[model samples]
Target chain A: MELLMAVSIGVLTACGIYLMLRARTFPVVMGLMMLGYAVNLFLFSMGRLATEAPAVIGRAETHADPLPQALVLTAIVIGFAMTAYVVILIIRGRKTLEHDYVDDRVNERDHGVAEQGLSKRAVAMPETPASAEADGEPRP
Target chain B: MSSHLLILPVLLPLLAGAVLLLFSGARLAWKRPINLAACVALLVVAVLLLLRATEGGAQVYVLGDWVAPFGIVLVLDRLSALMLVITAVLAIPVTLAMSAGTDRTGQNFHGLLQFQLMGLNGAFLTGDLFNLFVFFEILLIASYALLVFGGGRARVAASMHYVILNLFGSALFIIAVGLLYGVTGTLNMADMAVRIAALPAEDVALVRAAGLLLLVVFALKAALLPLGMWLPAAYASAAAPIAALFAIMSKVGLYAIFRVHGLLFGDMAGPLAGLGQSLVWWLALATMLLGILGVLGARDLRTLLAWQVIVSVGTLLAGWSLGTPEAWTAALFYMVHSTWMTAALFLIAGVVVARRGEARDSFMVDARIASPVVGLAFLAGAVALAGIPPLSGFVGKALLLQAAGFSGDMTIFWVLMLCSGLAGLLAFSRAGTSLFWRGPVAEVAAEQPPMPLMPALLLLVLSVLLVAGGGPILDYLAATADAMLQPADMIRAVLGDRYLPGGA
Candidate 1:
C-alpha cells in the first residue's frame, strides 16, 4: 500500500512540474492545482497510511493518526480557494491583454505605449491592449 | 494587564476585517475613518504588549484549555512583541497612504489590509507549524487581491506569477510540516524540538531532509537568491501602500527561520547541525550583490526600491546566518531599520510618481517636480537607504559589521556589505541627480492634486527617530536576541515541564 501511494505521489509531482513550466497561464494554473493535490496526498500519507482504522479514538483498538488527516483537509480547502482565485485572475488577464502568456515585459511595453498616448490626462491610466490592437493603430 | 491580552493583536484585526467586509459597500469616507481608528488602536495594543513582554519572559496562551503539543498555542516573547510593534507601526502609515486615494481604486481595500494584519500578527505568534501555514495562506491570499487591486494588465501578470510562485512555496511548506510531524509525532514546535533532540541516530537523515525543505520554503519567501525572481516586477507593479505593507512580509519568513532554527535546531552538536547554514550564508551574499545590480539596472524608482528590498533581505540574512547572539541582535536591529526605511522609500516613490505624471517615476524622463518638501523627503530616504552616517541604516550596518568581525569569515561579509553599500550609494546618486537635478523647468501651470505628504513624512520622521533613539533600541534588541538564544524559557512557557526531563 505504501509503495502504491509513493508511486502515485511521484507521478503526480512529475506531471505537475512539467505543466507548471509551461508559458501559458492556463497550464500554470492547472499545474498549481495538480501540485496542490500531490502535496495533499503527501501530507495525508505522513500518518503512515493505515487501512481499516478509525479516525477518532474509542472506535478501534488501533486508530489512524487524525492529525495528518485534519492537516490535509485544511490544506485542500485553502488550495481550492487559491485555485479559484488564480483562475479568476488569469481569466481577467486574458480579457485585458488578449493573450494567455504570462510575460510581464510584453504587457509592460503595450501598457507603456497606452500610457504615453494618453499622457494628456493627469492619471495616464492603463488601457486594454485588445482595444488598441482592434483599432489597428501602431503603439508609440 | 491580563495574560489573555496576548491574543488581542491577532483577534482585533480578524474581527475588524470581518466587520469591514460587511461594510465594503459603504462610502469610503465612512470606512476610512474606522480603518484609521482600528489601526491606531492596534498600534496602542502592540506597544502595551511590547512593554508587557519586556517585563515578562515568555507568555503562552493555550486554546480550548488543551495542553501544549495537543492544542494550538500562541507564544509571545521579546521577538514576537517586537514584530507586532513593527507591524502596527507599518500599518498606520500604510493605512494613511491608502486613504489618500489609493483605496478608492479597489474593492475591499480596508478589509484586505486588516486581514493581512491578522495573518502577519498570527504568523508571528503561532507556535504550531501548521497554524503558521494557515496564517501564511491568509496573508498571501489577501496580498494577491491587494496586488491586482487597481486592475492593470501589468499588475495582473505580476500577481499571477507571484501567486503561482508562492503557491508552490506553500505546497513545499505543508510537505515539510508533514515530514516533521511524521518523524516527531507532534506539530507543536516546542514539542517537536524535544522529540528531534531525542531521535535515534539512524533517523537523522530524514530529519535533516525535513529541515532543508523548511529552509527552502522560507528562503523562497525571504527572496533568497535562486528563488527570488518574482519579487522585483511584482513589487514594482503593486499599488504603493500595498507594496509598503509588503516590506514586512519577507521579514515574516526570516522571523520564522530565526524562531524555528533558534529554538528547534540551535545545538551545534545535534543531528541537524550545519544543515543549511553555509548554504544560507553564501546565498545571502549572492542575493545582496545581484539585488544591488538590479537596483543599478532598474528603469524606474519603484522597481529600484523593489530591488533594494531584496538587498535589505540579503543583508539581514547574511548577519543572521552567523549563529552568534550579537549577530542575531544586529540582524534584529537591521530588520527594524530596513522595514521602515524601505517602506518610507516606497511611499516617497509614490509621491515622486504622482508629481512626475507621464514620466511615472522613470529615471530616463526629465520632468521637473517643484515640491521642495518631496525633494527633501527623497533625499533623506535615499541617504538612509544607502547606509549613510547619522541614520538608522548606518547604525544597523555598523552593528552588523561589528558582529561579523567576531565570525571567522569576516573578510567576505565585510567586503560584500561595504561594496553593496557603495553600489547602492552610486545608484541612488545617479537616479537622484537624473530625477531631481537634470529635469527641465516646469512650464505648464496645470494645478496638481495635493500629494500625500503625511504618510511619507511620518515614515521619514520614524526613520529619523530610529537614529535618535539608537541607544535604547539597540539595548532592547540585544536583550531580545539573548532571549531568543535561550529557547528553554519559551519551551517551558508553552509545554510547562512535560517536555523537560524532570518535572515540577
Candidate 2:
C-alpha cells in the first residue's frame, strides 16, 4: 500500500512538472492543480496507510493517525479556492490581453491598455506627446 | 491585563475585518474612521505586547485549555511582539494612505487589509506548523486581492505570477509539515523539537529531508536567489501602500527560518545541525549580488525599490545564516530598519510618479518633479537605502559587518556587503541625477493633487527616529536576541519542564 501510494505521488508530480513548464497559462494552472493533488495525497499518506482501523481511540489497538487527515482536508479547501482564483484571473487576462501566454515579453504589446487605465485613474493629468512618442504611437 | 491579551492582536483584526465586510456599502467617511481607529488600537496593543514580552520569559496561550502538544497554542515572546509592533507601525501609514483615494479604486480594501493583519499577527504568534500554514494562506489570499485592488493590467499580470508561485510554496510547506509530523507524531513546534532531539539515529535521513524541504519553501517565500524571480515585477506593479505593507511579508519567511531553525535544529551537535545553513549562506550571497544588479538595471523607481527590498533581505539573511547571537541581534536591527526604509521608499516613489505625470518615475524620461519637498523625501530615502552614514541603514549595515566579523568566512561577507553597498550607491546616484537633476522643465506644469504626504512623511520620520534612537533600539534588539538564542526557555514554557532533555 505504501509503495502504491508513493508511485502514485511520483507520477502526479512528474506530470505536474511537465505541464507547469508549458508556456501557456491554462496548462500552468492545470499543472498547479495536479501538484496540489499530489501534495494533498502525499500529506494524507504521511500517516501511513491504514485499513479497517478506527479513526478515534477505541477497542482496537491500532488507529489511523487523524492529524494528517485533518491537515490534508484544509489544504484541499485552500487549494480549491486558489485554483478558482487563478482560473478567474486567467480568464480576465485572456479577455484583456487577448492571449494566454505566461511570458511577459509576449504580453508587453498589450501593456498600453494597462497604461491607459493607469493614466486615467492614477495620474489625473492630461497626456503629453512626448509620453505618447515614448510609447511609439501617435497621440490619440 | 490577563494573559489573554495576547490573542487580541489576531482577534481584533479578524473582528474588524468581518464588520467592515458587512458594511462594505457604507460611505468612505464612515468606514475610514473605523479602520483608522482599529489601526490605532492595533498599534497600542502591539506596543503593550512589546512591553509585556520584554519583561522576560515566553508567554504561552493554549486554546480550549488543552495541553501544549494536543491543542492550538500561541507563543508570544520578544521576537513575535517586535514583529507585531513593526506590522502595526507599518499598518498605520498604509491604512491612512489607502484612505487617500487608493481604497476607492477597489472593493473591500479595508476588510482585506484587516484580514491581512490578522493573518500576519497569527503567523507571528502561532506555535503549530499547521496553524502557520493556515495563516500564510489567509495572508497570501488577502495579499492577492490587495495586489490587484487598484485594477491595472500590470497588477493583474503580476498578481497571477505571485499567486501561482506562492501557491506552490504553500504546497511544499504542507508537504514538509506532513513529513515532519509523520516522523514526530506531533504538530506543535515545541513538541516536535523535543521529539526530533530525542530521535533515533536511523531516522536522521527522513528528518533531514523534511528540514531541507522546509528551508526550500522558506527560501521561495523569502525570495532567496534562485527562487526569487516572482518578487521584483510583482512588487513593482503593486499599489504603493500595499507594496509598503509587503515589505514585512518576505521577512515572514526569514522569521520562520529563525524560529524553526533556532528552536528545533540550532544545536551544533544535533542530527540536522548545519544541514542547510551552508547552502543558505551561499544562496544569500548570490541573492545580494543579483539584487544589486537588479537595482542597477531597473528601468523605473518602483522596480528599483523592489530590487532594494531583495537586497535588504539578502543582507539580513546573510548575517542571520551565521547563527550567532550577535549576528541575530544585528539582523533583527537590520530587519526593523529595512522594513521602515523600504516602505518609505515605495511611498516616495508613488509620490514621485504622481507628481511627474509624463515621466511617471521612469529613469529614462526627463520630466522634472514639481515639488522640492518630494524631491528631498526621495533623496533622503535614496540615501538611507544606499546605506550612507548617519541613517538607519548605515547603522544596520555596520552592525551586520561587526557581527559577521566573528565568522570564518568574514572576508567574503565583508567584500560582498561593501561591494553591494557601493553598487547601490552608484545606481541610486545615477538614477537620482537622471531623475531630479537632468530632467527638463515640464511644459504643462500640472498642479500636484493633494497626494497624502503625511504617511510618507511619517515613514521617513520613523527612519530618522531609527537613527536618532539607535542606541536604545540596539540595546532592545540585543535583549531580543538574547531571549531568542535561548529557545529552550520558550520550549519549556510551551511543553512544560518534563520535556527538557535532562529535566529540571
Candidate 3:
C-alpha cells in the first residue's frame, strides 16, 4: 500500500514539475493543479496508510488517524480557492499581456482573443493601441 | 488586559474586511473613512497588545476551548505583538495615502487591505503550523489582488509572476507541514518543538528535510536571493500605497523564520540543531551583494527601494544567524527600523513618481520638484536610510555590528554591512542629484497630487523617535530575545499540561 501511494505521488509530482517548467502560463497553471493533487494524496497517506477503518473513535478496535484527513480537507479547500484565483489571474493576464508565455517572447501566434487556455492579443498597446474610433476623435 | 484580547488582532480586521466587502458598492468618501476608522482601531489594539507583551511571557489563547495540541491557538509574544504594531503602522499610512486617490482606480481596495491585515495578523498570532500556512495563503492571495489594484499592463504582468511564485511557495509550505505532522504527530508548533527536541535519531533526517523545506517557503517570502527576482518588478509596478504596505511583507517571512525555525531547529533539537545556520549565513552575504548591485543598477526609484528591502532582509538574517540573545535583540530592532524606513521611502517614491510627470520617478528625470517640505523629508529619509549619523538607521547598524562582534567571524559581516551602507550612500546621492538638481525647476505642475507625502514624512520622523527611545526599546527587545532563546518556556505556556514537563 505504501509503495503504491509513493509511486503514484512520484509520478504526479514528476509530471507536475515538468509541466510547470513550460513557457506558457496555461501549462504552469496545470502543473500547479497537478502538484496540488499530488500534495493532497501525500497528505492523505501521511496517516500511515490504513484500510477501511473509520476515523471515528470507539466504533472499532482500530481507527484511522483523523488528523491528516482534516488536514487534507483544509488543504483541498485552499487549493480549490487558489486554483480558482490563478485561473482568473491567467485569464486577466491573457487580456492585458497579450501573450501566454511566462516571460517575454511574444510572436505571431499570440495575437488575437485568448482561446485554448492562452491569452488573446493584448487589449491595448501603450505605443499603438487599437480602438474603434479614429485618431483625434473626441469624446461625445 | 484580558487574555482574550489576543483574538482581537485577527478578528478585528476580519470583521472589518467583511464589512468593507458588504459595503463594496458605496462611494469612495464613505469607503475611505470606514477603512481609515478600522485601521485606527487596529492600530490601537496593536499598541495595547504590544504593551501587554512587554509585560513578559507568551500569551496563548485556545480557540473553542480546545486544549493545546488539539485545536487552533493564537499565541502572542513580544515579537508577534511588535509585528502586529508594525503592520498596523504601515496599514494606516498606506490606507491614508491610497485614500487620496489610488483606491478609486481599483475595485475592492478597502476590502482587500483589511483582509490583508487579517492575514498578516493571523500569521503573527497562529501557534499551529497548519494555521500558519492558512494565514500565509490569506496574505498572499490578498497581496496578489492588491499588487494589481491599479491595473496597468505592467502591473498585471508583474503580478502574474508574483502570484505564480507565491502559489509554488504555498505548495511547498504544505508539503513541509505534512512531513512535519507525519513525524511529530501534532501541528501545534510548541508541541512540535517538544517532539523534535527529543526526536529519535532515525527520524532526524526526515525532520531535517521538513525544517529546510519550511525555510525555503519562508525564504521565498523573505525574498532571499534566488527567490527574489519576482519581487523587484512586482513591487515596482504596484500602486504606491500597496507597494508601501508591501514593505512589511518580506518581514513576515523573517518573522516566521524566527518564530517557527527557531522553535524547530534551535539549540533544543538534538541532532538537527543549527541545521540551517551556515546556509542562511552565506545566502545572507550573497543576498546583500545582490541588493547592492540591484540598487546601483536600478534606473527607477521604486525598484531601488525594493532592492533595499533585500539588503535589509540580509542584514536581519545575518543577525538571526548568530542565534545569540544579543543578536536576536538587534535583529528585532533592525527589523522595526528598516520596515518603517522602507515604507517611508516607498511613500516618498509615490509622490516623486507623481511629480516627475512623464519621467515618472526615473533617476534621469529632467524636472525638479520644488516642494521644500518634500525635499527636507527626502533628505531625512535618505540620510537615515543610508545609515548616516544620529538617526535610527545608524543606531540599528551599530547595534547589529556590536552584536556580531561577540559572535566571531564578525569580519565578513562587518565588511558586507559597511559596503551595503556605502552602496546606499552612492546610489541615493545619484538619485538625489537627479531628482533635486538635474530637473528644470518649477516649470511644470500637475493636477492635485495622487497621494499625500505627510504620512511618509511622519514615518521618517519616526526614525528620530527610535533613537531617542532606543534604550528602553532595546531593553524590551533584549528581554524578548532572551525569551525566544528559551523555547521550552513558550512550549510549556502553550501546551499547559499536554506537554511532557521535562525534556531538553
The parts of candidate 2 lying over 4 Å away from their true place are A59-61, A107-140, B406-408, B441-450
Q: How do all models score by TM-score?
A: 0.93, 0.92, 0.93
In candidate 1 chain B, where is summed lDDT lowest over 10 consecutive residues?
A: B442-451
DockQ of each: 0.61, 0.54, 0.55
Q: Candidate 3 residues B429-499, lDDT tens each?
A: 88888887775864434553476898897798889999999999999899889888887668877887556
Question: Could you tell me the TM-score of chain A in candidate 2?
Answer: 0.74
Model 3 regions more than 4 Å off: A105-140, B406-408, B442-449, B497-504
lDDT (10s digit) by residue, model 2, range B1-504:
577888999999999999999999999888888888898999999999888887866899998888989999999998999999999999999888888877877899898999999999999999998999999999889998988887777888788788888888888898899889888899999889888888889888888988888899888888999889889988898888789999989989999888887777867327777568888898999999899899889988889989998898899888778888888999999999899889988888777666666777788657876567877887888778888987888988998998877466678788888887888888888777777777675443254333476788898888789889888888888887877767788888899899888895
Compose the digit string of candidate 1's lDDT tens values, residues B1-504.
Answer: 576788988889998999899988899898888888889999998898889888887888897788788999998999999999999999999988888877877798999999999999999999999999999999899889989987887788888888889999998999899888888889999888778778889878888888889999998988999998889988899887788899998898899889887777877327775468888999999999899899889888889989999999899889878888889999999899899888998888877776676776788646867768877888888888889987888888999999888466578788778887887798888778767777784333334333497797898887789889888888889989988776777888888876764453
- Candidate 1 has an interface RMSD (Å) of 1.0
lDDT of 2 by residue, A42-66 (tens): 9998888989876798858889888
Among residues 3 or more apart in sequence or in different chains, the pairs in candidate 1 whose N, CA or C atoms overlap within 3 Å are none
lDDT (0 to 1) per candidate: 0.85, 0.85, 0.87
* Top candidate (lDDT): 3
Worst 10 residues of 2 chain B by lDDT: B442-451
